[model samples]
Target: MQTHELIKALAADSRRTGVAMNTVWWGAVLVAIVVATTIFFALLGPRPDIAIAAQTVRFLFKFVVTIALAASAFALLRMLSRPETDPRGLLPYLVIAPALILTGVAIELIAAPAETWSSRLIGTNSLVCLTFIPLIGIGPLALLLLALRHGAPSHPALAGAIAGLAAGGIAATFYASHCTDDSPLFVATWYTIAITILALFGALGGRVAARW
Candidate 1:
């Protein structure tokens, strides 16, 4: 076959089959959770704060899990009605969320008051806020990369939502380890905000990157 024909054939394959990016993405999440949970338990076994931490962890965990579930439902809809949609393109952002969260934390810390800095640097509330740093950047960056590679997904909104939720879920797992708020209320309010910011970035990324 000619070069142009070969290129066309590859594109046709990509459009025909998303190739189960969700399986790979969700597998990464499950493995991360299992490994992180086992390590945390082994290293920090039965601490007095375990009960309190579990309470808070439950809320955050549920939130993250819910996003994945919701995305799955949406994916089913897209697959049935929008066969051209390529959800797999969202996978790259899984690797981008942590970096963005770290950047956000650094920016916030530098701008914080010195007196409050020490406490905030070592406090639960502060750590919770820090989680947002990468959450915002990851989705956008992933979308950008995927666009450069595959052009745009047939349905940008669906792709964006999948990317956003996947990133949010992974970041929450890390946040659970680093922060110690021990209150479902705190996770529901603060953690939700962080994920929301990231999701918004994902949407924006899809819009901007799709244009490229």
Candidate 2:
């Protein structure tokens, strides 16, 4: 068969099976990572030390969540590649949470003054509002992606809200590992704000992506 025919055949198979290439690829990656991690943990057995156990669990959690985020990012990219449809409609919200939270952290790192950055690196009690402020944009950007894709304005707000929540949760997981504050007040304050932006991104994007 000709190359064009093969391409057509593959596209048809993909649509018929309702499986996107990135989805399958990332799914396999996730499965492999999970299997490897499981095997490693099993081989190692349980550590008697509490700190070891805690660290092991934390690493596992991070690995799993990272896989999830990768899968979600693939889904979003798949949606972007296709024409606007229900499945595509869902991708922005699926991927936005992790994207935004990471972005917020990046912003935090960028905005910190040299001394403050050094202090925070050393686990000081310094607070940087600048770091937290840019995270607020993550959710909005998620919504923007949806809007740009859909070209309508119906459900961006709701989408943004959900995206924010997802982003915040993912962000908190990493923060939980590194953050020394360990205080409900700190999490409730900063993490809450970060996720709130994710939600807004969904809401704003919902309508934008709806354009048919």
Per-candidate TM-score against the hidden true structure:
0.46, 0.37
| Candidate 2: tens digits of C-alpha lDDT, residues 127-158 | 43224322423433343344334222223444
Which candidate gets the maximum TM-score versus the true structure? 1
Candidate 1 segments exceeding 4 Å error: 1-127, 130-152
- List, residue by residue over 1-212, the lDDT tens digit for candidate 1: 97556546655765665555444444544554455345445443333664566665343453344344334433432342233444565344343434444444455557666576545444456443554435433533363225322433555555554555545555555445445553333444566566666667666765555432
**Candidate 1 has which clashing residue pairs, if any?**
100-133, 100-134, 101-133, 101-134
RMSD of each: 11.0, 13.5
Predicted candidate 1: what Cα RMSD to the true structure?
11.0
Q: Pick by lDDT: which candidate is best? A: 1
